[model samples]
Target: MSHADLLPADVPVQLIDPDGRVTASADALPSPEALLRAHEALVIGRRINDQAYALVRQGRLAVYPSSHGQEACEVAATLVLEQQDWLFPTYRDTVSIVSRGVDPVEVLVLLKGDWHSGYDPVATKVAPQATPLATQLLHAVGVAHAATLRGEDTVVMAMCGDGATSEGDFHEALNFAAVFKAPVVFFVQNNEFAISVPLARQSVAPSLAHKGVGYGVRGQRVDGNDVAALLSVLGAAVEAARSGEGPQLVEAHTYRMQAHTNADDATRYRTDDDVEAWRSRDPLLRSAAYLTAQGLLTDDRVAEMDEKAEQVAAAMRAGLMADVQPDPQELFQHVYAEPTPQLREQAAFLAEELSREDAV
Candidate 1:
């Protein structure tokens, strides 16, 4: 109904349009081979999200937040990141985690209700998925500040959702980053809704990108559905931070085509038309169209990708079926490095009860 009510004016910094057109950029294009790899990653990332959604329906996964329309966000964010760079992701960031070299099987662990899925933060430099809203932003800022104090060139990219911006932690993290000149990129994927709350209700600022100015951080709103745009913006942001230009906030504008989580039902608050509207701008479709237009994708290629994705999905399903549920006693074993006396007693009590039940 108003200028602010409508989507923010699309900016020219983006390299890809929804029409599948490739716009010119001053930055050098990645080599054809590298571009091909990026495309392949997108294909795999999409399959990973799709299978995760199916697993949720089958009850193999406890809860899943689908990134079905956010492949570009994941691929682009990882593309510009050096292996040494740190990534802080929320629950929906597994696609980004996989792109950052995490094993797909391992990524599913957190979703399967096992704490063992969290990779070693020191080993992967990927902090475990922050389930508590925008808290990861603070963690990322801390890591970046440490790197800054050490005179290191590394950058930290923290990923969160539109809803997270409403939290106090988000503001605190941004303020800390700005004050300390932390080498952090606060990437927010503004996917229209945070759970069921529309962006309109989430913030009155019109654009999350504008919020960066309040904290003295640079901000840019990019087309999240455009892989090239994401790559370009994230690359610049990373380079800027590494060069001591300070933190940047990137608000990636996109839409969530699925429910907030497996437990959520969009039908309760949104309509089919809203979902269908976003479907027209699906990230996978836009990427496929661009590749096809460039003669980089063929019918045969499509078939091959589909077959491989299906095979991988089937294998994952099989693995889930054959997975041995962890012993209940394991819960106590990992509670402490040296078991506390109370914990040991509880463990012993459980063991005795199980043994008695077996004897009966």
Candidate 2:
């Protein structure tokens, strides 16, 4: 049977509504304590994203894809994974990777104009941020399939936006996973707009979640802003895939409150009113309200949480400000197992330039 055979069509399955009420059965609900933890993570991720955005404007970072409005999905996805699991993230998913306990400064190295990845992929189990759309999906499938063949239990979560769903690599990765029963979860953060093009202009599919059906994988839809529902669904999906249920696809219905990045102006394609409508449903706001109602977060506690967020922001700023001189020869580091003649010549030229500058 298809993994998504039991899911209803047209209706996106959402456990927590905008008001934070359980729309689905209470059985699937995360514990109250879990909700509070998720809320804290989302808040921290948002603060860090905002700090990165400000630095980009101040010229510290070349550019940063803000995760301001998508923190719920980002945090929940990372928290649901096991230590041995892998995460393949896009350029915009730095928040998710950081939540995996990566060094904040190293995670932003590429955005800081460094050419290679900051962290060791094997050690961290997180592939570097893929700027090319949907390419990471291909890498994710390869790793997941290898795990299956080796009889090791590893679930890989590959994250992308709705626009990346149209790429050929996206289709091939899902198809391969379905055929091989690869333990991979494809999380599509449908943030309403991909750059300037809205979802309406991307694909006319009834929903991006349904993309998995064609490849014989399970598919789900959830309110990306609802931390409770995201954790619940993603947690379940991760376990299911690990148990040989094949790949799964989850389309998170969300909105990007900020521009595509520090460089793009969202106002040109979308109206302010459109963004304002989503503010009422902001993930942190709804989650905090729910926690307060449950007596988990008093006003004093809220203040403490805000302080914690600020501290994280302050640390991220300090880390980014600290500069490390990159190795000049590192440019030829990963291009090939052994540098080709032409590449060696280029490396030699760069080496000479650096050597001359050092003497002065």
Candidate 3:
């Protein structure tokens, strides 16, 4: 049977609408003060997103799946988790990965073709950004399930795109997590189009969150562009999982403002008018307006933050351009305790090639 075979009753749960107006407010909703404090990280993430897009233009990045308009989902996802929690990110989640305490420059290492995964996963408590769609869902569930068996207080949060919901691996992960009552959170950033396919064509279900019910998991839907809403929902979900609650799904309804990647053209399927309409609903703009109304973010403060953003981006660019050579043996070092004969031969060949080039 399909994952949506037994959908939950439809309910639209949104804290704020596209106009930056609150539709519903929970006691758990982040206060203006909290939001103001959180704005810095969001700005930095947004700036980094823009910087990475520019890097793609300059050919510094082989491919960058820019999360331009979805910075709220990225930032909130990062902030909601405790340091001990595990974060599983997809290839497009550089913003969240970096925000989870990884060096920004290193997070781009994978995209730069320097290595498979950029950061130390063990140290960061984050799985490497999964390039294969929904594969990390399985990994996240496995870790959570194992933790549950060990009676460890570990909560795993796995993120995937809207398209990933359709994958068999996602189905298996959710099903298993539900059955095991594993302390895991499945955060689906539903940024409208899955690559080029619109959400309308992607599913006929009432909402992406409802799919959780089919697996006997509770679900939530929120304005993905609304950082406060995301923080509230994700915070609650994280808390529940931490307290021994079963797996849950959060569907953050946001829009993807750019192409799937530098390689895809969004204009091919969506009109400029559609993208323009969402521009007014931009995540950073919405939060900035809210913060400005609270008198928490002054013009001077904004100018300062923007300038800092540019500086950070410039530094990031220089880091990417710097000549920091990785050991050629890195390819074989971590694969196995004892390298297989074939792997040893390949590593030797790579070393020989590097040695020959160095001699010249």
Candidate 4:
């Protein structure tokens, strides 16, 4: 299909409006049941995000990034992937991984500072979260390239933030994917900031989707808060990549509804008004509105979803806290597959210090 064939020339690739109205492609996407499920997943995602923040406040976790307003971006995007596909997600994609079948408890293990929590890629086809921004794009390209070489049907979905579009790794990954015709989708969730830096300061380009033009790859921007729109666009992109059409770049336009991380002070750089404005366009609310409009949701159903999410979140939080009372010996366990001489010496030193304190 030509560039003009896939999306309307003027609608900016939207399938759902902020007020829960549907467009042409929206009906072609998920079923009402699926949409309701996505809504429930967003509730779960938000609860997980909220719980992590609470844990951070209680000193149970080192840091937590909020994906509060980007639930549609995460769930709908992951919905397009096949079981054989691979995913490379950044720290903000907890919902994506969860929606793609990764256990939430295993995900928490990583956030709670446990090495054993890092996912086995062979089991999950999802990489451990990349904290350094945009580096995972290169890994995604490499994985896709390998799949092509081995005549495998596997594709890759690499998730990043809008800020990541400015990274050198982003540029390199795009170039490599385009030149090699790698089966990859570079999904960018433009939540309006790189930590505290606003979108304008991060890039001169009016839209991140335009970045793909420089690499000769297909690109488009979608309303990230619209679950139907995200699912539609991602489905097209995933199909294109799997069919050997090379890479596609999807820039999901959304906003963050909370601080960048627990350690961040968003109030210092952005106003409460700014957050509230985006909260009005929140993915969870939009999905709930859509479901209610379709008669798939009721107040009772919403309450049930909220209660279940809360219960699961509470259990995860309890488990996380139970593990947070650090085992001093654990410091020696995973420094290396086997400890190095220097690490072994440091572990011994720490052990001796603890022993002395115990004796006293």
Best model number under lDDT? 2
What does the lDDT come to for candidate 4?
Answer: 0.84
Stretches of model 3 off by over 4 angstroms after superposition: 1-11, 17-19, 25-28, 341-360
Preferred candidate (TM-score higher): 2 or 4: 2
Candidate 2 per-residue lDDT over residues 32-124, each given as its tens digit: 788878887887888888899888877789999988889999999999999999999999998898889887788987899888788989999
lDDT of 4 by residue, 258-293 (tens): 888877888999998888777678878777777888
In model 2, which regions exceed 4 Å deviation?
2-8, 338-360
Better of 2 and 3 by TM-score: 2
The superposed Cα distance between candidate 1 and the true structure at residue 240, in angstroms, equals 0.9
Worst 10 residues of 2 by lDDT: 2-11
Q: Give the candidate order by descending lDDT.
A: 2, 3, 4, 1
Clashes of each: 0, 0, 0, 0
Ranking by TM-score: 2, 3, 1, 4
TM-score of 3: 0.91
| 111: Cα error in model 4, Å | 2.7
How well is each residue in 126-172 modelled by candidate 3, as lDDT tens digits?
89888899999999999999888888888998999999998899889
| Model 4 stretches with alpha carbons more than 4 Å out | 1-11, 324-360
Local distance difference test, each candidate: 0.82, 0.88, 0.85, 0.84
